[model samples]
Target: MTEPDPPPAGVAQALYDRRDGRLALEVVDAPAAELARPHRTNYFTAYWVRAGRGTFHADGTRHPFAAPCLLFLTPYQAARLDPDDHLHVTAVRFHANFLCVETHHHEVGCNGVLFNDPYGPPAVTLDESTEREVADLVARMRAELDTAGLAQAELLLSYLKILLVRATRLKRGQQGTAGGGVRLPPPLPELRELVERHYRRLHAPADYADLLHATPKALGRLVKQHLGKTLTELIRERVLNHAKWELLHTLKPVKEVAREVGFDDELYFSRLFRKATGMSPTGFRAFETDVRGGSNLSMPSARPSIPPPPPTGQNADRPASDPPEPGA
Candidate 1:
């Protein structure tokens, strides 16, 4: 596979703010044009494409998007825009310290639906009416960011919450229609919740089956049919996602990260990580740091011009060694 182009030389590292270290929010009316190239950011990003037609490449998948849609990207996800026509885009970026999606998931329900659902598209197509609603929210957010006042962050966050909630509803409605209005089985939804809660300790499909009061065979079949992935693959992907986040955003050692993710053997963890991400833990951290031109905590004055390493084998999003599900 071809490697992605590095950020242009002398490009400043993207940060929430250099003045107030505590503030972790930024609203860009027109972000850097180089975003059309493959690049990853250290913060959560939402691209409000007011007018555009393009293919959004994220984590090795190409999603075709059009005007008046919202594209969501999690931190450290590889992304690029290939516009078929001139694109007018506004970017909103925020660090996890500013607003933790998991903490606010109960209110907005965007933790999985908008930001981190591995099985779903990363872009939300908006109808004309919903587009107007989102555009109003973005305008208000921009206005709030420009002004300095008390509870500004709170107000901005409230607006963000509303935007997320609306997008989540739209995305769910679209998904329901696409799936012919077939709702997931009870066990499938429960399985997602169980995996999110217990993935660290419980690594097997049978473990989740026991918790959901279903046979592993049945649950695995359902997952494969609906989600196009095996149960083991789902668990491993979640584990690797956490591992990648820790690797990118924190200075934790690989051994510590491995143990935190329920692997007692650091070497085994490294092997699995390499199999899934095309880089060992240390290498992934070092390479991503170099690509971003600084550690997550520090800002770089200029980005270095260095090409990224190509994939070792298969796409990192799909591990080659994912075991087949029971009775597959």
Candidate 2:
């Protein structure tokens, strides 16, 4: 027989947050010996195990399933569900647009995609005490579902946040199946770390070279060689990225934006933003506010001048993109 259709999107749900978005709670009881290819759910989902057992094939490996084990499947992963016995599955699905509106929110890729680690799928198995917390959150969700009113969306968000945090803390998995995980490179991944830590400072090239204990010329040469851009380029990209985020998301003033990104002078920040983005912060925000408001956040008109590769962990905040290690 042909496989049945996957569950409908947003079934058993309603509009909330001024009808800005919706969420679904579903209970599935099934008995199927074998299954077809792994299923892909475009919307974000968190599946909690209430009863029965099954094995999940995800992130290129099989994760054994038992009752009370929670799985956090991120957007765009393929997973196969096969029940060893019958299956009782409780799931929550929410649209991304409600979380943050994107023009074409349903579009294939999630920008600002955080945590691309699949072998890094969050698996948290709840112990008895923690399971009660999970149960309480679910109960609240069930109660929220019963009432129909204006504030339900905000209340739902509150409960969902509680459940997600609790599940991540209690059940998010600590181990990946052997050999299914990606290897963090042998050398320390440093440049990205530097960017991550000091990007907020918006330090200049010379500052970084000093921190890395190398001459500015050597650092520039090494960075361009590995990362294909000069040190000046990396700092600007991060500063600009943060600038864009604040412009589009927060109503923070121009001066505050400069301060947050380490530009003492609002005028300098405006100049730098224009150089990188081809527009001032106000113009950038106006553009995004026009399209996505929460809809269309603008991208750098030019590609990152120096898109440094992940740094070697050895030199905590330096880029492997920089010159070879002295010992090496």
Candidate 3:
């Protein structure tokens, strides 16, 4: 897999890279040009817009939001932000390995609900109060990162979990899955995580069932019941999504892209790609390249070129909070 690009100039530098790169975090206040362009990342990102009005596109859907909302993207998910000048976003990004929902299933409860869901909308619109709460948490994270002292990683993990928990509640409510006493389906979360981790390698329901310690028949039933798709379909969808991202964002050959997503036979991969996406791989690449104005994708550096801190003095005024009226 290609290394993740570093966070852009506006965000804070990574707090730390743990387990040799399983976890990291940054805050972004990127420029208008960068925000308008389409890009893909190999990490889970929670983009909180404190002030802005725009649409955030993920996977093929456009999620529109004013300020005080959170937009989500799982690893390899394609995204683009088109916002007005009032855009002031705080983006928190991390890899799945950093807080693997599979491992911390009970603590965060975000695996299938927030990051891995293929069918639900991607952004969670926060109320004014919720937005402030999340923004406060992010500010705390920024302060903690700057200190870079003892147990900072542990503290950051705790803060991250809190953010996810809050977002999960909002997401569930938005999707009509919220209730006082409702519980998530037992196997659905793990199943989604497994597919995310192994989709390129394991293409069958039985393959996942074996790892989940359940029979293929039982697992298939649970997946279809809760997720509304057969296990094989979910796997194929993920593979195709990643394939499309690679095709659009990178200059790799069709065969190389196919191999990247686990298909060895280029012809077979092309056939499947055409069937699922309604376009041949080469056609998709050409269309996307033209649409993107021929910007070549590259690995974003992990080390951001942080801009100098703003001057500190009595003359410094606080930034404005209200986003402009829709078209204003």
Candidate 4:
């Protein structure tokens, strides 16, 4: 079956179109009506809520939020903010190519901790001081955004890195053992990083076990003990997540999407997708478009628009010129 044309560019593009597809920042006292309904974006988002209260939805999970909080949304993660009218929010949205977390994971660990985390609340509750610090960083970013300096993009990237680092620290603190007691297993962080880096190519728990230098049995035990799921389950979740994103965002054929996610056999991939999501990939793609608006199917673009890679000259695993933290 032929796929339809992609949906219209979202509000972020409306805000950043003149910037030539790089980054956009805005302080929103009022969000559009569509934001209250579930929607996904093609860029990463960070929302700092300054006041009021509401429930923030991510991937069908509802997280309650109060004032002075930080919320994150990765690309293609379905999210909605049912926020009160008085809510004040500072929103930062950028394409993956603009500041690729996959490229700079070693420098700032926000990709796993803040954005693509499958285990934690997408919203981080902030203490007063941390909130103030992040607000200052956002303000600095806003300042750089307003001026057309030679290093404007670099300056904004620096501020963004610092903000991500600060949020990572806070998120780690929040996930620390309750009652200030038990130490988490040391392998957990590396495990998450490995999964994020290699999930596209490695779908088996044993593959991750070999990379970690641990026996498959031992690694599986650790994952189940800490994360409450078997290691295989975790790996599969990551693969399915990427597959779903491709289905929603790209016009790739089902076979191509399957292969992109490491499934060489399209039929097997379709079976797995059906088992996990209760629909075939084609059905899911059509359903996503239909719900977003009325069905007006059109021919796919000649060149399918896949998500952007890490910026040129940067290694996928690590960048050579990882920007320094703000005030560092």
Candidate 5:
């Protein structure tokens, strides 16, 4: 099956398109360490704190947001903010049609990739000056709604666009310094599909590049630019996670499990396992039973991280440049 196209560029129409006629933003007081179950919502959210500090765990990394900071989570990104004490928060949430104007549309537009990944870090942070600027804008936005006019919704939409543009601009500025506009190669859809189907086996960079008719460097760069990982790193992690899984379940012995997971010699398998994880196969199993109930496993259905490594020379564990934080 093909992946669905991301939503098009329009706020009000998109809101009407996603959830008809209900646009709202609120300032609520809440405690620290708030947890959220994995879920999807139909509104954009901007959470800015005047003071306080906490770490936001999204995707797989932790973004530590201190005072005078802002975090944008696209409508579909999954996250839970562990707010700090005395959290002075401003949140702006609205439906799609609200951002129908062409200018606002570009901020959210990008093949929907910006909105899709939650585990990535935030795009940018507001310094003291920008914080005051945005905070005042949000305050005015919060106010004008009470004194409704024919253009009340229109005015609110304008503020929303301003805020999004400012934030996106800040992100673009930061990205410009590090690097910017490193486009992913074509054939991503086919490449992704191939990864999805055969991640458990295909690890060699060339195997993937060969299948997709791209160069290994190009594929590596694509993964880094889009997914925040090199092709080899992705493949290795996937294989490692699966090795952990089969190690804890089924009747496969250490050597067989190694072979089953793309490792041939049991001794070499032990070395790779130690490299990926800080434990030996037998030691991991022992720890699992001793620690978490029986299996050192997530579930039979736990998917591999990516695809298995190409069975040779694929370890540059941490990519020098991972993808920028989601919603960037």
Candidate 6:
């Protein structure tokens, strides 16, 4: 199918409570044109593509999706849609402060499964039953958003929680079914957890292997077999994710950001960042800021007329960068 034309340039602000700056939650029946362009949001977003056949691009992957699918995007994750025909979408957005996805990870299990799992697809295909349930939940959320009542925020949050929980459950079921109900090896899961905890300080796979009580070579082979990436690559990706978050969300110098991510040599860090993302640390910040019109609090009101430069080399084949945190 042919991709739709891009939208014109403009500013697009996300929904947020005017009285409370920290509380940002909105449910909108977004226009197709608004989504046809690459943009980033300060809040987490989920698009319920009610009726559409197109490619959904997020981070650096192109996810071709049809109707009755849910596409997820983390904060500052650049994304766009290209529909073959008319596209109907409803978007639900909420900042971390509004729902604290990490805090509710135990309840919904969406922190990595739905949002941040680098190895997983960014789009989830929903079955008929799951679609109906999600639609009902979204409708209730829309109704609550429109009403001005006591404890409205609490009620809306409950609905959002249910929606996330259901989606996570469906995704997990699909994963298990696809893998013939086989679970990952013990150390693989532990490696991810350890990377999340120590990516800033531990740059070597040997460090993780020691922590997991496995030989480095055995653990490395396991990672390559299951995740299709080297242990070193996994650790580097985690470190880069943190660096991206810091570069976009803070005014910290590139050197400081590099140091925070365990790199003492700023030049080496910049070289690594550029190779992975197709842009230097400084260049990335500048380009993204320009794209957002100097604010990461909202998506472009309109899509940029000029397309972003296509990534080159190794990055061209895989997701090269992580979803950055929103800028203050």
> What would the per-residue lDDT of candidate 2 be over residues 1-328, giving only the tens digit for each residue?
1121223242221221212333433222222332324555433566677676766754334556677756555433455665677655666655443344133324322222211222132345666887788778777777777785778877876676666555544422433222223433311146556767887784777777777677889777755543334667656655665676678667788899899988889998897766444456676565435333243334332333235577666775775557876896
Worst lDDT run of 10 residues, candidate 2, spans 10-19
Please give the distance, in angstroms, between residue 227's alpha carbon in candidate 5 and its true position after superposition: 8.5
TM-score of each: 0.61, 0.43, 0.53, 0.57, 0.45, 0.60
Compared with the true structure, what per-residue lDDT tens digits does model 3 show for residues 89-158? Answer: 7778875335655347699898767876674556788887898889788888888888988999788888
Q: What lDDT does each candidate get?
A: 0.72, 0.54, 0.68, 0.69, 0.55, 0.72
Between candidates 4 and 5, the one scoring higher on lDDT is: 4
State the lDDT of candidate 1 residue by residue for 50-112, as single tens digits: 887887876555567788889898765667788888888888788765676754668889887
Off by over 4 Å in 6: 1-23, 176-237, 243-257, 260-262, 267-328
Residue 299 deviation, candidate 5, in Å? Answer: 38
Candidate 3's C-alpha runs over 4 A off are 1-23, 177-267, 270-328
Query: Cα deviation in Å at residue 285, candidate 4?
Result: 15
Comparing candidate 4 with candidate 6, which one achieves the higher lDDT?
6
Any idea what lDDT model 4 has?
0.69
Tell me the lDDT of model 6 at 144. Answer: 85
Model 6 C-alpha lDDT per residue in residues 1-328, reported as the tens digit of each score = 1111222243233323223344478888989988987676657788999997897766445567788889888764567888998899999998765665654678778987787665555677788998999999999988887785899988998999999988888887766221334667676766777888888999998998999999999998977655546788778766876787677667888999999989899999998886555457886666554433334323333444335566675456544354333651
lDDT of 2 at 123: 48
Instruction: Name the regions of candidate 2 deviating beyond 4 angstroms.
Output: 1-37, 100-115, 171-296, 299-328
Return the clash pairs for model 1, or none.
Answer: none
